[model samples]
Target: MQFHLSFPISPLVPGIQHNQQLMLMGSCFAEEVGAQLTDHRFNTIINPNGILFNPLSITRALTSYLDGKLYTESDLFQHQDIWHSWQHHSRFSGLSKEAVLQQINQSQTTAIKAVEKLDWLIITLGSAHAYTLKENSQIVGNCHKVPASNFDKRLLTVEEIVTSLDNVMHRLFFRNRKVNILYTVSPVRYVRDGVVENNLSKAILLQAVHHLVNKFNRLYYFPAYELVIDDLRDYRFYKEDLVHPNEQAIQYVWEHVTKYCISPDSQELIKEIAEIRKAAAHKPFNPESEKHILFLKRYEDKVRKLMILYPQIDFQPLLLSFIR
Candidate 1:
């Protein structure tokens, strides 16, 4: 009784344990998956340059770290009483240029360090559509609410997308030869670009990812786009805006990721940690009841024993919570 087709994911590398470091880039979906990885206490960092979608923008951010480029006053433009860089997400903008540079530079320092030790680099491509600011003819990561007339919007060709990913792969392989790469196309619809354009953009991204995966032996695709659009093809799977995957859809895709990508040992520990997480978040009606206190003590013991087994997992917060 197969109601839906499932994507065949590649075998996860043998050494990908909970303690292994991972670097996540591209799209909000990357952030979504990274959040769960972080929740389970996987050593992971998400979109150090923020949620960039287009391939060129993501590569630019990665390469910037390699080149040791930090945003300066010259790189920022004063707009609406704030300083913003076209290379960064709007969240990084600040009232003062120095403040923005401080945040951006700090994050780059962290990302550069993370990149040096990454065991896995997960990339979730969102779209092939890119916007180059007409003023400088540069591929800007975000427009920061500037008028559309100020930017030239264009769809990236398959070759163009491949070149960007190729650059990323070359840099990563040069720096960290042991890092395995996982590529996924985000299922989030770009309805703002029109439905036809959205599909065309995804087609390009799909082709580009396929080309890169074929070119590099350590690279693989997870079929996250197929998971939502094909496996759970229902309007109910979408959020109210009909653009993003709802909780159920996200969970389904994450479950597939766990089954296919995460190691069995880490998966088992994640289940145990989920229970401990559940108990940690639980709040009793009686704030100081003996029953609640005893429950907290049991959770504390459970955490200490598990921490002894897997020292990588963070049991500090739960310990402090129970203590408080």
Candidate 2:
């Protein structure tokens, strides 16, 4: 008996290969999937500016990268002895203004090079609700624990979201015409905004994504939002907070991503990589046991073989770990 609805996602044509460069931006879901792709030895960069929830903030970050914009003291504000950028996440905040600018610019520098040759750009939009600073009406990517009284919050309209992202898409294509964009609405619910408001925000993002995807030939949509919400409709798939997906649910989504986005040959390679990774992580009952030593030698041989087969991947870490 079928216990859950399984919606088959359409495969992306010319599936992603191991050698191609990819970037994942927007919400925490991007981080989750990007980490998995990196583990499998795919060349990927995730959230160069940090986790951004709203589309406008995401677009602003991407625009900065395309321009290779450098942040200075004027762009930062000191709060409680720490410096923060309205355009960056709290991760970039630090006690020293110079140190903060250095961190932010370093990421920007890396992103400038990555985006130029990027093959796939995966975006996971989390919400349409945005917060803007009242002092300058500038959208803040991360509030950095700033008092709520200092900012005004509002739900972004569909037209506004579409227009902002449309401009970003154009800028991205101009930078790299070969870059293909894959859009997904994050399944993580923003319950703090109220359940209904979260749904409304997601609706706006979904509409905007489709609008842009339909307008552009290189754009595609992955039904991650539908897969989690409608297909696996259960509280069990969620963490205790009932907001983020549990590890099991994340794996389920990862499986779907592999099946739909990755090439068949690469999928087979991923399984081999997974086996090698599992063996590398194994901790036996007896460290000096001959059986364990044999296990390590076997995986060491596998890693060497894989390295020879895919010279692009760096298996040095796994190779060193297998060393006695």
Candidate 3:
């Protein structure tokens, strides 16, 4: 006698709702997606590790990149105002430049904590290769500094990637019973790496991540790399560097993501968001109302729209107090 067995295939859902909190991490590409979601009023918590500079700093850096002045350390440091604000924040009490540099030598504890609250984890693996610091033997996200002689780009094996992911997932599951994981490989070519080895490194990462996605039941892989290479292979979709995806490419990626990950209620919220965004885009700022009155009106308009869509979601009264 022969027996037939059946397995359940999970239904693919659309993009998450506006009310769902999202936590984004991994590479710089994830930062771009996080910023877009934030602009659409999604509750996006970026870079849980807090080692990287905050969102405002990222915006300033992107502007510098656009202006063709982001090629040097001096240019990057020109956006110090964003970091200065963090210094005054109570959470950063003991955080100094030296301390942060030292902390980078240790495993990322803050990133581990941030992943704990995430309903959906969006990780974009930039490279399988990483530079390890001499002092603490910890993996550095980017090798922007540290004498070239002291560092070597060590490419992680599939096992290493799986182990690292399992470690993070273990912590997350211990904190919360269930969590969904999404992985993507960044499509940006490492042009500055100055070696064929760079492309090989990305290929290895792509292969390894794909393997993990297939093996894991809960993890999902998004075709970000394919979308760039296959769907938007045209050079026009890229920035001046001919590497990073331009705004158009990013929009295309987001639309594809929305099709698979978003829910019905979230889709409705996004439609409302589009209307709000259009209204805000067309409205002129009235400067003469005794303390930036037009800003208040805009805030009120946004609040009204949010209330109309999510009347049950209670917003803090203090949230409105800041508008005036």
Candidate 4:
């Protein structure tokens, strides 16, 4: 007898390679996958303008990168003595405007370069709901703890979402014709928007993504939302807030990603890297012991050997961690 519904995922053609430049954009779910790819030594950039939820905000951020837009004082606004960009996540907020602008501009520089050479672009849309400041009628990526009364909330239509994303794809393909896009609907639930409303929001995102994926040969969709909401279908997989996926749930999706999205030839390399990572994370019972010293030396030698074997990978961080 079967316990849960587990479906097969067809492997993506021309799957992700370790040497290729990849970018994971969109919600917090992107952050989770990006972190895993980073740990496995994949050359990847995650969320340049931070984690954007709706398609409009994501479109805005991507276009900014394509334009190499620079953030200035006029682009920023202060609330509670902290400066923030309506187009950026709270992570980019700073006490001083100069500090905030410096970080934002630096991210834009890196993001534009990343976009130009991007081999794979992974986008995870979180929701269709968007907030626009009532005063200026401008859509915001984040509220930055602003009063809800100051903004008007609306759920984006499927056509609107598709049009927004279509514009992004047109510009992106023009700059990097070789780029392949993978779309995923984030599984994180926004209960603040009401349960029925959240479902409706996700449905809109899914419809828009599939519509675009069908229209573009290089576009693909991953059933991340279905994997969590339908396959797992358990409360235990959720965090305390019942909104985010817990560690186990994230690992489950990541396992599927490795099996379907990444190149099979790189599996052995991933396993070897995981082992080295685990060894690096080990905490010794006796830090001064000869056995611990030998343990460190062994991993250091392993790192050096691996580095020689895969010259494209940067193992300096792991090597340094093993060194001392």
The residue-by-residue lDDT of candidate 4 on 1-324, one tens digit each, is: 999898877789988989899999999999999999999999988998899999999999999989988888999999999999999999999998999999999988999888989999999999899999999989999999999999999999999999989998999999998999999999999999999999999999999999999999999988889999999999999999999999999999998888889898777789889999999999999988999999999999999999998899999999998886
TM-score of each: 0.96, 0.98, 0.69, 0.98
Instruction: Write down the lDDT of every candidate, Cα atoms only.
Output: 0.88, 0.92, 0.58, 0.93
Q: Any runs in candidate 3 off by more than 4 Å, and if so which?
A: 1-11, 50-114, 134-137, 283-302, 311-324
Residue-level error in angstroms, candidate 4, position 277? 0.7
Taking all chains together, the TM-score of candidate 2 against the true structure is: 0.98
lDDT of 2 by residue, 1-324 (tens): 989788668899989999899999999989998999999999999999999999999999999888888888899999999999988889999998899999998998999988889999999999998999999899889899989999999999999988888898888899797999999999999999999999999999998999988999999999989988999989999999999988988999999999999999999999998988888888889989999999889989999999999999888987988999
Ranking by TM-score: 2, 4, 1, 3
Model 3 clashing residue pairs (backbone) = 14-261, 14-262, 15-261, 15-262
> How many clashes (backbone atoms < 3 Å, residues ≥3 apart in a chain or on different chains) does model 2 have?
0
Superposition TM-score, candidate 4 onto the true structure: 0.98
Clashes of each: 0, 0, 4, 0
Q: Rank the candidates by lDDT, best first.
A: 4, 2, 1, 3
Error of 3 at 279 (Å): 2.3
Whole-model lDDT, model 4 = 0.93
Better of 1 and 2 by lDDT: 2
In model 2, what lDDT does residue 218 have? 94
Find the candidate with the highest lDDT and give its number.
Answer: 4
lDDT per residue for candidate 3 within 66-141, as digits (tens), equals 2333122221111222211221122222335444433422323443444446677677777666666566564444
